[model samples]
Every structure is written in C-alpha cells, then in structure tokens.
Target: MTTARRKPYGVKGAPYAFLLPATVLFSSFFALPIGYAVWLSFHKVHVFGLGLGKGARSEVWAGVENYTDALTDSELLDGALRVLGYGCIVVPVMLGLALLFALMLDAEKVRLAPFTRLAIFLPYAVPGVVAALLWGFLYLPDVSPFSFVLEKLGLPQPDLLDGGPLYLALSNIAVWGGTGFNMIVIYTSLRAVPAEVYEAAKLDGATPLQIALRIKIPMVASSLVLTFFFSIIATLQVFNEPTTLKPLTNSVSTTWSPLMKVYRDAFGTGDIHQAAAEAVIIALATLVLSFGFLRAANRRDKQEAAG
Candidate 1:
C-alpha cells in the first residue's frame, strides 16, 4: 500500500489491442472517404487557357458555391421527389407484409413454417441487380409470362416499366427483397416473449387476435422501430434496382434517384466536385431524416409508457 501498484502489461494493453483492427479499418475505409468527400465538396476545378490540357485545370476553393448549386439543381430536386414517392410505397407495403408474415409464422397452427419462411426469405439472398433483371424480364410484354397470360385472357397488359405503374414495379422489387429480412427480425422478437405472458393473456380470455394485437405487438415494438429505421434508410438510398432496370426502360433516367444523380455527376459528366457536394447533401438529408424519425419514435414510446 505504500507504493502505487502497476497494472499488468497484457491487461493494460488488451483493450487497445482488441480495438486496433476496427479503428484501422474504420479510418481507412469510412473516415478517410468521408473526409475526402467533405474536402472535395468545398472545392471546384478552375480551368484556364481554353481548358484544353491537364495543366490548364486546377483545384480551387469554392466555398459554398457547389452546395448552393446542388441545392438549387432541378434534376436533384426532382430525383428527391421521385425517391420520396417510391419510399412511400415501399416502406408501408414492405413492412406490412413483413409484419403479416412474421405474425403468420408465429401462429400455433401454421404449417410448413420453416419452408414457408425460407421461401419468403430466399429473394433477399439474390443480388439486387439480379433481382431487378429477373423482374425486368417479367415486366417485358414480349417475354413476360404474366403478359402472355393477360394477352390470352384478353386483359389489358399494363406497362409496368413506365408512368405510374413504374413506381409499383420498383416498390415490388424492394418489398420482395426486404420483407423477408424484416419478417425474420420481427419473428425473432416474437419468439423472445416469455411463454407465461401468452398464458396470462389466454387466462384473461384474450383471443389469438387480441393477444397478438395487445401483447405481442407492444412487446415487439422495439423491433418494429428498428426495422422501420432500416427501411427508411434503404428507401432513401434506392439505386441498385432502378439502375439495374434502366436499360430495360426509358422511364428510369440517369438521374432517377439522388444517388443515381450523384453517379451521373461524378462519372457521367466528370464533375467530381459537384457530385461530392450533392453526395454530402444526400448524406446530411439521410442523417437528419433518420435521427428525426428516431427522436419522434422515442418520444412516442415515452408517452405510451407514461400512459
């Protein structure tokens, strides 16, 4: 007790050693790329002498000019609107189907539960591009079995790749791919409820529907919130499906979504600075919307608990 005790070397350094790999990877992949994007967002290419050669073009500080232009860009705004509409359809339908399937799987009398779950979840295993291509072929009038059946039945074949139906077409792909994952999350949550809780509900004369609505749903609220959070983020970042379907239809433009516009700006037009600015804006929007939703959910939970 007279002298301060020294910690063992291994114990003292163990935490840091454990964290080193994660820190390095995060710095290399996430931190560096984000930092570079922020830096690029604040700069632009200054061209001189007819802008002909590499030496004539140089990087210069742009301040908020890039941001200003991005915020006002009509294409970006339109893309954002399109994505918002797409999200409206995808979020509700996907989550609803997921919840429905999870509840069904949790039912006592459900048959072939494992096979049914696997069948629903299998689409998520397919790559987004492949899923889109598969759906794209099915949407085509010349190749689709659905279209052929409709033609034989004398029903008008709706154009799924253009106009209003295009939204449904894209939303279906997202729902098909996403619903299974969300279902599994909710189903796991459902499984975690203590058996005694269900017994107590049954003793209180609660029917299966009542037990599900009052007990199971409330207990699994946290999982629902989590799935909703992820669904929102995914909806905001929709790119792969639309991009994959672009070659099959004229309705999907290069700027069909915000991320698509970023791709077009950065690579299509070789305007990296503007692209970076737009990318930052999208990131900020995503963060703001995501956090705002989380805050609202937390507040509602607090209110419900108080009641």
Candidate 2:
C-alpha cells in the first residue's frame, strides 16, 4: 500500500535537521564562551567603603577600562613579545622539518617508510600537555640524556630551562610535538601527486630534486599552505607546553605567553574582563595573520601556474 507524503521543504529540512545538533554544540562550546567573554570584558567589580560585605562588593560597568588596562599593561606586552619570539622559532622549524621529512618519505628506496611514518606520527596521538611534561623532564640536566653524555665527557652542562636557550627549549617541545602531525599532512598530499606527472617529469630528464622542487612542491602547495596556516595558529595558541614547563623552571613567569597571561588573568587573578579583551585581541591577530598567509600562498600558486 500506502505511504505518507513528505512536506515540500522536508528535503531542505533534512540537512539542517541533521546539522542542528552540531550547530547547537558549536554554539554552546565556542560561540557562548566568546560572547560571554566579550560581555565580561566591559564590566568590573565595585568596592565601596569597608569592602567587607556582599553589598560593598558589587558588579559595575567598566566601560573599556579593562581593554585600556590590557593594552597598556607591560606584562601583557612582554608576554606578547615573548610569544612572538617563540612562534617565530616554532613555525618555521616545525614546518621545515615536516616538509623535509615528507620529501624524504616521497623519495625512492626510502627505508622503513611505514615504520618510520608510524613512529613519527606516534607523538601526534599524545596530548599536548602530556607531551610537554615528557619533554620537560627530558630537558632537566640531571635527567636529560644529552646532559648525561656531556657529564660523562666532563663538559659543562648548559641549562636548557633558562636564559636565551629558553626560547629554543620551549621551541623544541613545540617542534617535536607538532612536526609529526604536519609531516603526515604534507606527506599524504605528496603521495597524492599523480604517477603520470612524475613519469612525465622523468621523460623530460628532470632529476628527483627538480621533480620535487618544480612539480611535487607546486602540486602540494595547497596542502603546504593549509599546514602552515594551522601551524601558525598552533604556535600562537601555545599554552600547555609553556604552562607545563613552568612548574620545573623559574624563568617562565605567570605571564610567560599571551594565552598563558590570559589564563592567569581570567582564572588566576579572577579578572575575566581584562582577559576577555586580551583573548579577543589574540583571536583577531590569528585571523589577520592566517588570512594574510592564505592570500600570499594563493598569489604564489597563481604565479607558479601562470609561469
């Protein structure tokens, strides 16, 4: 027999209906938090005389006071500069190693490729906090393998957890923890290059380096751009690594990085308003930098295509 007739717009309703749950979840977790942070950014607490009663401590509208304070705060500025330096080291080194490893994997007669790939990617499975903890301990002179070898050879053991080396020390953790994931991304795209393309390049008497530099790299440019975009964001949002390392090192202040400073302000100092302003600033910076990178990459791709 008989079947019920569907509504005319039911076809359209079906997709949105399926997406409703995800939309709700995204709103709840991401959108609401952002909105609330923004709302809190424009308010502050009021303290009357005596400051000892519930009525004495009241919430009041701050009127951009928090934003002004955040912008002028030397600690926040220092944290931002520190993070910039850290990101400068992390982004290039991680992406470079990723591209290098990916190209190596794409090479002929590569040994232990499957095993090497799995090994390299294994760290990606580790949580960033856990990875930082593991690497933090390894940076300790008494516990580090490098320091152990140096000690055996009667050489001076340098402190990795402090001073100028602190940048590289923090950077190494980010690089090690991130390289594997970026490598796999670049390698997967590298593998997707057409076999015919390589054959054509070979027919033209191009060496492997030429094929990679000219063909594979060009073909994989989109993937490189995507990876670099994500890597830059990750470098900017570097909180877990530096925060985890703080317990073991003194150089890392309560405001070591911008995100860490936000965390400290919001939770540590119980000032969500100032933190919110800083958070919004960071989010904007991320969007600007990421969009700029994508445009630059696209321009290069177009140039390559035209040439």
Candidate 2 per-residue lDDT over residues 163-246, each given as its tens digit = 989999899988888899999999999888879999999999999999889998878878888988998898888889889999
Prediction 1 global C-alpha lDDT: 0.95
Lowest lDDT 10-residue stretch of candidate 1: 1-10
**After superposing candidate 2, which stretches have Cα over 4 Å from the reference?**
1-12, 303-307
lDDT computed for candidate 2:
0.89
Model 1, span 39-64: residue lDDT tens: 99999999998999668989999999
Off by over 4 Å in 1: 1-8
